[model samples]
Target: MTDMQHKPNGWNLPINQMTEEEWKDYFECRKKYDIKLSDEEIKKIIKIAMHFIDTDHDKYMEESLKIPVPPNLAISYKAFNGLKAMKKFNLSLAKETYPDEF
Candidate 1:
């Protein structure tokens, strides 16, 4: 299908349905040569990422019957948030040093 076929309104498509060549083009367009998210935005993204981590971990256990949950199958929200915050902070620093990369 042509790229236009995937546009719901303005050219956004479901990533899973993208053809190889179309996906390549999409990535090319998304290549940010000089864009850095603000600290606030990065923090928000990390918070969202924590939710995904929890979801995927549960999904994996459900899918793999042989896998057993540990006695303490718990994740510390505080620690994860802290680590994510630090990671985003570091990414911002790297972006400053290499002002021409994603």
Candidate 2:
């Protein structure tokens, strides 16, 4: 699919093209629990996620799958949120850093 056709879930526009409201909505949707992450923290997490996705997708996926679901739905949801954010941000960074690959 063309880059324009393959946006992250719930993201109709590319990350770079998103408006402030859209960006906020996107992140808010991914936040499944009350746990708040600062913008800087999110950026750091995304950077780490991108590194893992670039250097060791297989291992990352394996480890991600091993994350156990907690008894509390909120906890489980938050974990899912974190993973989803990581993957989405990683894809965005990859596309930016390696445009030819896309």
Candidate 3:
């Protein structure tokens, strides 16, 4: 099957990368949960989930033995928003030394 034929199973997949069915499911989910997030917020969430987290506790669920269980949307959204805000606050407090990042 082609990539488009593959089902998107995660909330972490970027919006631009989602398949057509995935987009339908995504909108349905957002509507059901009353989630209204900007594209940038969604991107920040994807970035954090894909790049920053070392361990995903959600992957441990036993749903017909699926290896990677998708993270809970409400929890992830709330946590990601708080994390984004906290990181922004922390960055403001940190000293800017030379070569802070390589």
Candidate 4:
């Protein structure tokens, strides 16, 4: 069997293992935009990044639709809205970083 342990995707680390440098870079890259992402928000971003490493952009978008809306109406509304915005942001970032794939 092929060993997928040392693949290019850095999935071996914990999902939330974003470094300070990564956080800075992420904000810097989007600095011109009006978007602001909190640390909690970045977790979802990282999750999407990891997902894309394993799958393709189209598959990621399709899977995002299946995210369960939160039970609390207020939270559910905000979460869904944030998800939509983040999806757009991530897509743009992906296109810039990996033009061939996105």
Report per-prediction Cα RMSD to one decimal. 16.2, 14.9, 17.1, 16.6
Q: Which candidate tops lDDT?
A: 2
lDDT of each: 0.33, 0.40, 0.32, 0.38
User: RMSD in angstroms, candidate 2?
Assistant: 14.9
Candidate 4 residue spans exceeding 4 A from truth: 1-33, 57-102
On TM-score, the candidate that comes out on top is 1
Error of 3 at 100 (Å): 52
Between candidates 3 and 4, which one is better according to TM-score?
A: 4
- Per-prediction count of colliding residue pairs? 0, 0, 0, 0
Tell me how far candidate 4 lies from the true structure as C-alpha RMSD in angstroms.
16.6
- Worst window of 10 by summed lDDT in candidate 1: 69-78
TM-scores, each model vs. reference: 0.29, 0.25, 0.23, 0.24
Ranking by lDDT: 2, 4, 1, 3
Considering TM-score, which of the candidate structures 2 and 3 is the better prediction for this target?
2
Clashing pairs in 1: none
Q: 1 or 2: which has the higher lDDT?
A: 2
What residue pairs clash in candidate 4, if any at all?
Answer: none
lDDT of 2 by residue, 19-86 (tens): 55655554553333223345676566556656677689975664333232223432233235532344
The sequence of per-residue lDDT tens digits that candidate 3 reaches over residues 1-102 is: 013333223324342344467545544432333233455755655565554345664432211121111234323442444221221121211112211210
For residue 6, give model 1's deviation from the true position in Å.
Answer: 34
Clashes of 1: 0
